[model samples]
Target: MTTLYLLGSAAPPVLEIASVIEGAQKRGYDVCLGLTPSAARWLEPQLTDLEQLTGHPVRSEYKAPTGADVWPRADVALFAPATFNSLNSWALGLTSSFVVGFAAEAIGKGIPLVTMPCVNAAYAQHRALDRSIAELRGMGVSVLYGPDGFEPNQPGERRPEGYPWHLALDAVARRTA
Candidate 1:
């Protein structure tokens, strides 16, 4: 089975992550779930259920060097609903979060990577956002943004179902095929 690292940030779309995992599984992926720290907190109650669903532990923090690897090597990775902070941090090569760190290293390791941000129009106006997206693309990471991928809504508008998860999954399928 294709191993997929499905990482996420603390965006509203992350609340429905279980369905996203099921979507990946239905597409024949062996999924491993990872989240940003705040995302983990947001989904704390569902963590165990998510672990059971993926058959892998949900990791938000780095593992101890002494521990053995729990997840399989990823053939592809999808970092969806990546918040503004995480996206910018990733492009800047700051990997304080586990998800961003793994993605940063994945570039050097040649793992196929895709990302879709879930920022509002207000936050998307930041000058760094465009630069960050460009940086990720320069590293061969397929960034799904703007009109086709994830169009930012107004500040308070929530559209979890509108997140184009299929786009993320499909991009990985193409990359790893």
Candidate 2:
């Protein structure tokens, strides 16, 4: 079972991620979702659906389930709709939430980490954000999709409906194929 850790934040692009996760499962991949507090609010129903679909519990807090000893290992990690706050936090090694903590741990374990940042053009242009991206890349993490132009407040405006999802899944497929 190739474990996929789907990390997301409160950004609107979460709808895109919802579609991606569902699509990925349809293609026969085991997915585990980890959501930031803010992202949880936007995707509450989908989170439950994801759990049912993947047969693995969705996690939003570190203590949700622990002491299992043999935690599922991820083959791929994708952070979509990565908010600026979460990005900065992750880049600085701050794991305040389950998603962030899982990401930090996954990266530390040398798993393939991919992030698709979804922030407004203004925030994306910030020097700190740019530097953080560079630092993450330098650490061998792939910015799977980002610095792509996106306007704020558009709930489901994906660049090419399903293209980004395909790209993300392709990354994992290539490795496991």
Candidate 3:
């Protein structure tokens, strides 16, 4: 089975991450969950359920190198609700978190990647946002944002009920093909 490293950040859409996993499973991916620190805290209550659903432990931090890897090698990496902090940090190759660490290595390893940012209009307008997107795209990461992708929401407003979660999976499928 194809393995997808499903990395998530602290964005609101992380609250509905089950849907993203389900969507990827339907596309024939064996999904493994990697959460940013804040996302792990937010998802604390659902960890067991998520583990059962994915048939693997949700990893929020790096494991010691003494043991064999718990999860299979990722065929692709899909990052959803990629936050501003994570995005910029990732672009700058900061591996402070497991998700970013994995992403940084994945890029260097030439593993296919897709990212969907969930930033609001104001945050999206930051200068670093554009540079990060450009840098990642230049390095072959398929970033799903802008007019054809996710539109920025207004500040203080809840995320739209219609966030396009499947776009990430579709982009992965296309890249891996």
Q: Of the pair 2 and 3, which is ahead by TM-score? A: 3
Q: Alpha carbon lDDT of residue 63, candidate 1? A: 93
**What is every candidate's alpha-carbon RMSD to the true fold?**
1.1, 3.3, 1.1
Model 1 has an lDDT value of 0.93
Per-model TM-score versus the true fold:
0.97, 0.82, 0.96
The true-structure Cα RMSD of candidate 2 reads 3.3
Model 3 residue 61 distance off true place after TM-score fit, in angstroms = 0.3
Clashing residue pairs, backbone N/CA/C < 3 A, model 1: none
Alpha-carbon shift of residue 103 in model 3 (angstroms): 0.4
Per-residue accuracy of model 3 over 1-177 as CA lDDT, tens digit each: 899999999988899998889888998999999999999999999999999999999999998889678999999998888999999999999999999999989998989999999899999879999999999999999999987678899987875466788777788899888
Ranking by TM-score: 1, 3, 2
How many residue pairs in model 1 have overlapping backbones? 0
Ranking by lDDT: 1, 3, 2
Which residues of candidate 1, in runs, are more than 4 Å off? 159-161
Candidate No. with top lDDT: 1
- On TM-score, the leading prediction is 1
Candidate 3 off by > 4 Å = none
Candidate no. 2 TM-score: 0.82
